[model samples]
Target: MTTTSVRARFLGDGRIDFERATLGPVANGQVRVRVDVCALCGSDKRLLRSGSPVVPGHEIAGTVVDVGADVTVPVGTRGIVYIPVFCGTCRRCAAGRTNQCLHLRELIGWQRDGGFAEHVDVPARCLLPVPDDVPLDTAVLGLDTVGTAAHALRLWQRTQPDGVDRALVIGAGPLGLGVVAVAGAFGVGEVDAFDPHEGRLATAVDLGARAAGDLAAENQYDLVVEVSGAAAARETAQRVVAPGGAVIALGESDEPYTMPATPRWRRTDCYTVRSFYFPTSEVEANWDLLRDHGAALRDRLTVPVTLAELPDAFARFVAGDYFKPCIVSEDAP
Candidate 1:
């Protein structure tokens, strides 16, 4: 059965165009999702400027409306789209590290058509079931915001098995605020956050982070999470982390990640841990985190908009007027 879907196309240089397209008879191994909500992310800003060949919204929460051959997911099942199109048979996937799948190539919103539309066709395996208690807007955060942040912290725990005494988050954007919200749950003590935007920093404080007073003070924090891909923020993370501490880098930037060859940089001994999106293995645990903190985070970070208002939402998002703008469908339950 074909469905007519309204989707957004990102034309280069901050332009958005909509198209009404004929969607499928459901491709094999894929299921069609009627997008309930799709949250805008900071990474989308780069795509906004440069343009994307595919639909660009990855933080998706929706209902499975149709299924392909061999699929057993019932229609009307609620889920958040998992971006990574992993080869489930790969060695990494077998080990539950699906994010690092050996044959991974496409991410739903990056290489494939995604949920900036009335409906999106995604690999059946990419549909992560959302709990009945969680709203679609909040469930969307379980993808990028909470998922990435939790993965970064879990990786840090591998190096610092004793748990963090004090942690610092650089950049209080959605993901940074996410790190703040879950840090205490991960056994981190005294979470502090630094961001140039007063409003965002205040939101971070409301999420349980103390305002970081000095970004220049060296050797203070046990763990420093760099969620803003700004070069200066990267530098600050390295400077402030105590020796033997870990710096979890979750930020994405077009600019090359570099380390300046200064004396302090040369001498400081610390772990620079970089993590990708969360593995499917962690989804259950993440649900628990979301149940505890998701609604509050969503209330502070999201401004709801209709799909047609996506262009304006992006403008406000770029202007720092919206922390996380979500395109909510009128039919959304």
Candidate 2:
């Protein structure tokens, strides 16, 4: 039998065009997913607009269309693809830390094709079951944004046992919105979010946060988080960390940007920069956490779009539209 699949490809310099591709027989520990709904992360926006031959979507949810010989996923199983692929024999993989494996750069969109397509081929270990109650959009995001936030939250809580007395999130991107929503769900006190964009600042307030102009001015908070590390945000966070407080750095970019460090106060704890990756043994940890807050996150993920609308959606991505725009297929649930 022969099969054809449709997917999107970026032809370097900011052009994303529709294309057709084929899938050969599935390999060991691999499965094919028919994408239902995929959320475009900030990185996808950057990469797509950078003009590269890359598949754009990383946060993807779909049904299992086929399974490789050694794969256990049954056809029709609904799930999201965990994009961090690793070679099992490597030292990092052997220790069950696939995300940090040296070969991670070679997997998913970079070396192998990714989920901007109708069908995605992934390792069985990378497919996570989508909860029946959670919608496809939420499922995809749970795998990344929410997962990272929960991981950071756990570490943040460990640093200050009294529970969140005050919190600061610095960014207006989707991840920042997600951090705001999670902070509310987890009962953070004095939720102060800083973003220059009036629209996103208002959205933060709507999501149960108190919008503020400068985090450093509101520096009384015990916990500070850097989500995007913009020049302004970095400058603000240096002043925002409370004396002896813990700061979680969650942003993705590391340009040659020099950040202004705020004068240190003696009663202070230096910031902690966390760039977390997926944990393997904690199998489906993200799904479990999402189960706890899926409904509300589903509400946060209410921004909707269509497959044919991808070009427009991506254009808006360049223009910064919506708090978090989610691309959906006709039958997405």
Candidate 3:
């Protein structure tokens, strides 16, 4: 049977155009998802600006429309596709960390065409079952963002220094807010989040953090969580981190940021840990961290938009104003 699919394709040199394509039946080892909702991640816009011609959206959640022979998934079953594909025989996959595998591009939305399309194919091993009640739009958070946050939290707990009661999260974007919420859930006595944008600061507070005054210089906390991708925020994190404290730099800013010249503060007696790929990778690690906080947070943080509004929302994101804008599939499965 033949079917039509809609897609938001990046045609290179900072261009994203929606187009129609035809899809054929899945073959052995492949599963097809009737796309539901997709999220515009920070990485997508960054790549566009950097001149990479690639499918943009990575956070994807949807329903299974077709399963190749020998595949275990049932038709019409909703799920989130784990983006990291692996050849189990590889040393990295053999170690059970698929994301680190060398042959990991077969997954949707990264090496191949991603979820921006109405239908996406994936190797069977990368599929993960989404909870029946979880909204497709929100379920994508589990596939990556939440899982990444959870991973960062676990890493921090393992590397934390003594006498750290507070955590300073330096970015107020969705991932920054995610770090804040997870930090709070991790039992940190206080969580102070920072963002230059007032609108995102409000969103951060809603996600369970006390908003810091927009990157203004302050010497305030013991633990610094830098999820802000700003180049300047790195200095802010280094300045605010207390003596013998830990600075967890989780932000993904494009610009190069230098630590404050003061080696006494940034290096001496302090721990600097670069954290990434949290709750987004290890389910067992992220599940317990977010068992109580799921799609509810996404609902509070996301602004639902249809495909038609994508450019406008992306424009807002470019101007540093969007807060987890998720696309609603016109014909969501």
User: Best by lDDT, which number?
Assistant: 1
* lDDT by residue for model 1 (1-333), tens: 999999999998999999999986999989999999999988888889999999989999999999999999999999999999999998899999999999999999889988889999999999999888888889999988999999988988898888877899999999999999999878798898899999999999988889988676789888999999999999888889898998898888989989879899889888999999999999999999999999999999999999999999999999999999998999998
The number of clashing residue pairs in each candidate reads: 0, 6, 11
CA RMSD of all predictions = 0.9, 2.7, 2.9
- Residue 23 of model 3: what lDDT? 82
Best by TM-score: 1
Candidate 3 regions with alpha-carbon error over 4 angstroms = 12-14, 50-52, 102-107, 161-163, 213-219, 257-261, 265-267, 278-281, 284-291
Q: Candidate 1 — which residues are off by over 4 angstroms? A: none
Worst 10 residues of 1 by lDDT: 208-217
At residue 36, what lDDT does model 1 achieve? 94
Error of 3 at 310 (Å): 2.3
Per-prediction TM-score to the true structure, in the order listed: 0.98, 0.88, 0.87
Which digits, one per residue and each the tens of the lDDT, describe model 3 over residues 1-333?
Answer: 556887776655566678788888787887888767888788787666653344557777778888888898888877777766677677767776666676755545666777777788777776777765556666677755677776667667776623346788887777777776666666577788777688878877877788675555455677888876677778788777777677887777657756666645535467777753522247655545445666656776777788767777788767776677777787785
Give the clashing residue pairs of candidate 2, or none: 12-51, 12-52, 13-51, 14-51, 244-268, 244-269
Error of 1 at 168 (Å): 0.7
Q: Supply the global lDDT for candidate 1.
A: 0.92
What ordering of candidates by lDDT runs from best to worst? 1, 2, 3
* Residue pairs clashing, model 1: none
**Model 1, position 107: C-alpha lDDT score:** 90
